[model samples]
Target: MALGGGTFTTMNKILPGTYINFVSAPRASAALSDRGIAAMPAEFDWGPEGAVFAVESGEFEKRSLELFGYPYTHEKLKGLRDLFRNIRKGYFYRLNTGGEPAKNDFATALHPGTRGNSLRIVIEAAEASTEETPVYDVSTWMDDTRIDLQTVKTAAQLHDNAFVRFQAEATLAATAGANLTGGTDGTAGDAAYQTFLDQIEPYTFHALGCLSDKPAVKALFTAFTKRMRDESGVKFQTVLHRYGQADYEGVISVENGLTGAADDTSAVWWTTGAQAGCAVNKSLTNRVYDGEFEIDTQYTQAQLEEGIQSGGFLLHRVGDETRVLTDINTFVSATEERSSDFGSNQTIRVLDQIGNDIAALFNTKYNGQVPNDAAGRVSLWNDIVRHHQQLQTLRAIQTFEPENVTVEAGDTKKAVVVTDRVTPVNAMEQLYMVCVVA
Candidate 1:
C-alpha cells in the first residue's frame, strides 16, 4: 500500500512515499456580464400571477398570443412593443391577476383576466364519426380566428391548450359555438405592486420601470430601488414619471409626458428599455425616440435647462425628431463620497458594472476557495486590474491605474477588503466653439 502520498499542510507525515500537489496555473478571472435586461410590473389583462416571467425580444412578436392572450398587433401590447424595441429580454409581472376567470360549459380560461372573455369553443361531428365511435372536432377560438383544433371522442380526451383548460366531466356535444363569459380584471392596488417588487427581487435586471403616476406608488418603487442598491448591493436604476423630488441616483425621473395616450407614465417603458439596452461606453443623450407614442416635447430652452438642473430626464424635439435631452438621474444633491458624476446614468452604469462583475469574480473564483494569504490577495488584485484594463479598452472608463487597486485582509481571517478607483467616460453632449475672422 502507498503511504501518505497526498497534499500536506504541516509536513509532519510519518512514512510518506511521495507527496505531490497539483494546481491550475493562475489566470485572470475577470469577465464582463451581458446587459439589455429589464423588469416591470404591468397591468395586463392576462398572464401568470404572483411570479416573474421572461420575455425575449425575438420571441415577443411570435409568441405574443400565447404569452399575453393577445395577438402581436393588438392595441393592448403597445406598451410591451415599445419596451421590447430596445431591450433584449424583459422580466414581466402581471399586476391584475387577482381576478375571476371566464368559463363555458366546455372549458375555462387558463388565467384570470378580461381577455379570457374573448374565448369561444366550437364543437362539431367529425366526418369520420359514426354511430359506434362519435368523434368530435373541437376548435378553440379567440374572437373570429380559430386558435387551436383537436379531434377527440369525449370531453375527457380534450387536452388543455395555452388559452384554456377543458372540463373533463362535461359531455361532448356538437354545438355551433359557446362563448366564455364573466371574466374580470382586478384592480392593481399598492399591495399587488408590492408583491411584484418582492417577487422580482431575486431577478437580475439592468433597469426597472414604474408606470404608476401616483406619488405613493412611485415612492414605493423608489424605496425599493434604494434598498436594493445600498443594502443588497444590487445595482439598478428605476424609471419614474415626474419623480425628480426623489433626488436619488438610483431613480430616473422622466419629465416628458406622452400625448394621445391614456397612460401618462407610458414614456417610462421606452426609457427603461433604452437604459437597460444601452452599452457601457454609450449614452442615450440626443438618441432619437423611435417608439410608438407621441412625446410632448414642447419645453422651452430655459425650461429644459431648468429641468436638467433639477435632475429630470427629459425629451425634446430636435429637427422634427424627439430626442433625449440628457441621460441623467435624480441626484442633484451630491456629497463628497458621491460627487456630481454619480448623477449621470453613464457613470452609474460603469460603477454598477464594476460592482457586479467584481462581486461575481470574487464569489465564483476567490471566495471560500482560495487561501486567505498574500498570494490570494495578489491574485484578486491582478484580476481586478485586468477587468479595469478591459473597461479602459472598451472606452467605458479612462485613466485606470493598476497601482490604484489593492486587496488586503479584513478584520476577520475570512474577510477581505478591496479598494479600486476608476474614471467613467461620458458622451459629448455639449460643444463650445470660438472663431475669429480678420
Candidate 2:
C-alpha cells in the first residue's frame, strides 16, 4: 500500500499522504410530532377479535360497514361518532372478542359477532352457462343489500370479500339463499378489558378513554397510565369517569356524564378525543360540546368551582350550548417536583410535546450514531434549542433560554446526559378587572 488516507484523532501517522476527516455542518434535527390520535377499548356487537384496529376520521364514514359491521349512521357507532368528532385517528380494541362466527355451507363470516347473522349467500346459474359446463353467480348479501358478486364455474375460483370468506372446497349448487347462523357476541369482563390494555400498550396515542363505570376498571386504567407515563416515558392522559381520586397528571377525571345514556361513562369518549385533538398551544376551556350525546351539565356555580378545585374536568351549559368549564386533569396534590401548573391540560400538553419530541430527536438522530464528545453534545444542545424556539413560536412554552440546556457525557463512555428546562404556558382562563371612574 502507498499510504494511509483515513481519519485520524492524532498526528501520529507517519505517511506523507493526506489524512482528512470530513464532517457535515450541524443542522437542527428536531421536529414536532403530530397529535390527534386516541385509544379506546369498546364492547361492540361486531368487529375484529382480540386485536387493535385503527380507524381514521376521513375513512370512518366510508369504511364503517366493513370495519364495524354497521353503517356510519347506525346507533351502534354513536360512541365512535362522538370520538371521531375531534380526533383524526383512533386505535380501537374490541373488549368483546372470542365469540362465534356465523357460517353456512357456502361461506363463513369474516369476524365474530352478532352482525354476521344477517349475512346470506345466494347462488344462481349465470346466463353464459351451458348444460355441459355451468357457471354459477355467487352473491353475498348482508340483509337485503348485495355486498359481493362473483361468477365462477366452481367454488374453488371464488375469492373472499370484506364481509365473508367463501368455502373454496364446497361444491357449487344453485340455491335461493343460504343464511349464516349461530353467531354470538363475546362478553366484556375485567379480563377482556385487561387484554385490551395489554394489546394497546405498544400504540402511541395522545389520549385513552376508559368507558367503564366500575371503580376497579378505572383504577386499572389509571395505574396503566401512570406506569406508562412515569417509568416507560410514554406520555399520554387517560380519561376516566368519576375518577378524580387518581390525582395524577396522566389522568383526567370527567365529572359530568350523559343525561339519558345507559352508560354514564359515555362522556369519556368525547373528552378523550377532545383532549387528544387539542393543540399544544390550545385549551379545551369553553370548547362547545358538539358531540352526539346530551351531556349532563346541570351543575351549580359552587359545584363548578368545586369541580375545578378538585381537579375535575367538567362541562357546563354556556348559553344554549354545553361547553368545557375548565381544561384540567386529576392532579390535585402538588409536590415540589410537580407544581400546580401540572393540573392544567394545556401545560401538560406542552410538556408532553417537549418530552416526546426531544426523545424522538435523540433516538432517531443521536442515540448510537453521534459520538459522546464535546462537539456531539453541542450539536444536541443546538437541536434542543431550535426545538424549544419552535415551541416558543407556537406559544406552547415561554421563557426558554438556550444557555439553560446542557448536554454532557455521562460517567460511562457510551452514555450521554441532557439537562433541559422549559416553562410551559397556559391559557388565560380567568378575568379580573376593575372599572375606573371617568
Candidate 3:
C-alpha cells in the first residue's frame, strides 16, 4: 500500500479476498426509507475506509469490519486487508507523459490493454549530430543521415530522460479522447445481459483502485461491507452452458440400448459412425437420467453425494477435457459405490476459475473458456451475459424488449442482480448501475 508518506512499503498481512458492502450506521437524513438512504439524488460510494454518502448537506463517512474465515494470522497481514487499498489487480496501464511509477503518480495517462512496445526505429537525422537516446544494452541511432534518434524502448517504458525515444515529441502522437459520456461499451449487444454473465476478476479490485465517487476510503469500506450482506443472498451465476460432446456413433448390446432390440442377441459391430475423426467420446457408461440439474463446480465428493440424494441427479458443467474426465471419474465412483443413478458432467466453472462461485454479481450470465487475451475475454464474456438476460436474469433489463423497471421514489438504490446458475464463483457475471429514484 502507498502510505501518505513519500516511502512505499510492502503489506504482508493482506491475503486477497472477495468482499461487498455492509451497513451498520444509521442515516442522518430521511433519504433512504429502508437502507438509510438520504432520500435525495446522491452518490453512495463504498470503499475500504467506510460508507460515503454524497448528499446536498455534505458527504458522510462510516467504517466497516468483516468476519473472515482464514485460519492463520500474522503481523505481515496486519493492515493488509484495509479497505480501498491500491493494487495491480489484473490491470496495467501507461502513466501520463510526466507520470512515473517510481516517481509516484496515481492517475495514469496510458489506457489499459495497450500492446507491449516493440517498434523498429525509423530515425531521420536532423539538428546536431551529437543527438542520442538512452543507452540500454546498446545504443544505435536510427540511420537516415537526416535524423538521429537512438532506438530505445517504447516511450511508455522509458519513464524519463529522452530527447528522442519511444515517443518522439514530433513523431509520436497519442489519440485524444474525452470522458465517455455513456456506458463503458460503445456498441450495444446486451448491456443488461452481459452484466449477468459472470466475469471472474482477480483478488485485485481492492488493489486496482477505482476512480469512484467514494471521495474517501472510510466511506467506501463501510458501504462495501454493508452491501455485501444486505444486497442479496441467493449467490450463484446462472448459465445454460451449452455443450456439443464428440459425435458418438457406437453400438452396444440390445439390453444396454434400452430398446432390448434383437441386435443385442450377439456382440454386434459397435460402429461409431463418423465421417470425420471427431473422436466420438463418451463417459464409457455416462448418462444422467436423460435430463438436467444445477450443481456447484466447487463442491467435493461429499457435497455431490448429498446433492444426488435430492433425486434429479447432479453434475458439473465443464468446458474442457480435464473437467470432463474428473466429472466422469467422480460419477463412476458414485454410481459403482451406491449403484446410484447419478450422472457425470454436472459441475460448472462460474468464474472460469478453478471453482464455481459468483464474486461479481452484476452480469446476468456465466461465460467460460474465453481467450487468454484481455480484450477477447471481455468480448466473449459480454456475449454470455446477453444469453443470461434472455433467460430470466433480470426481467427489468431486457435486450430487444424494453421492459420498464420501477423503484420507490427518492430511492437512490443500486441493485446488482446476479446469475442463479449451477455454482457461482461470486458476482463474476453481473450488471452494475446506480438507481435514481423516479
Q: Where is model 3 poorest over a 10-residue stretch in terms of lDDT?
A: 268-277
Candidate 2, 30-111: lDDT as tens digits: 9889999999998887788888999999889898988888888988888899899999999998898669999999899998
* Best-performing candidate as measured by TM-score: 1
Question: What is the per-residue lDDT of model 1 for residues 1-438, given as tens digits with 9 covering 90 to 100?
Answer: 766677776778798577777889866669888889999998988888778999998889899998998889988888898899889999999887569899999999998889999999999999989999899999999988799999989999999999999999999889999999989987887788899999999999999999988999999999999999999999999999999999999999988887765348889989999999998899999999998888888789999999999999998999989999999999999899889998999999999999989988998998789998999898888899999999999999998899889899999999889988889999998889998888
Q: Rank the candidates by lDDT, best first.
A: 1, 2, 3
- Please give the CA lDDT of all the candidate structures: 0.91, 0.90, 0.22
Q: Give the TM-score comparing model 3 with the true structure, all chains together.
A: 0.17
CA deviation > 4 Å runs, candidate 2: 1-26
* Lowest lDDT block of 10, candidate 1: 256-265
Q: RMSD for each model, in Å, please?
A: 2.6, 3.0, 27.2
Candidate 3 local Cα displacement, residue 139, angstroms: 10
Candidate 2: lDDT over CA atoms? 0.90
Error of 1 at 371 (Å): 1.3
At residue 4, what lDDT does model 3 achieve? 34
Error of 3 at 195 (Å): 6.4
Show where candidate 1 strays beyond 4 Å.
Answer: 1-27, 260-263
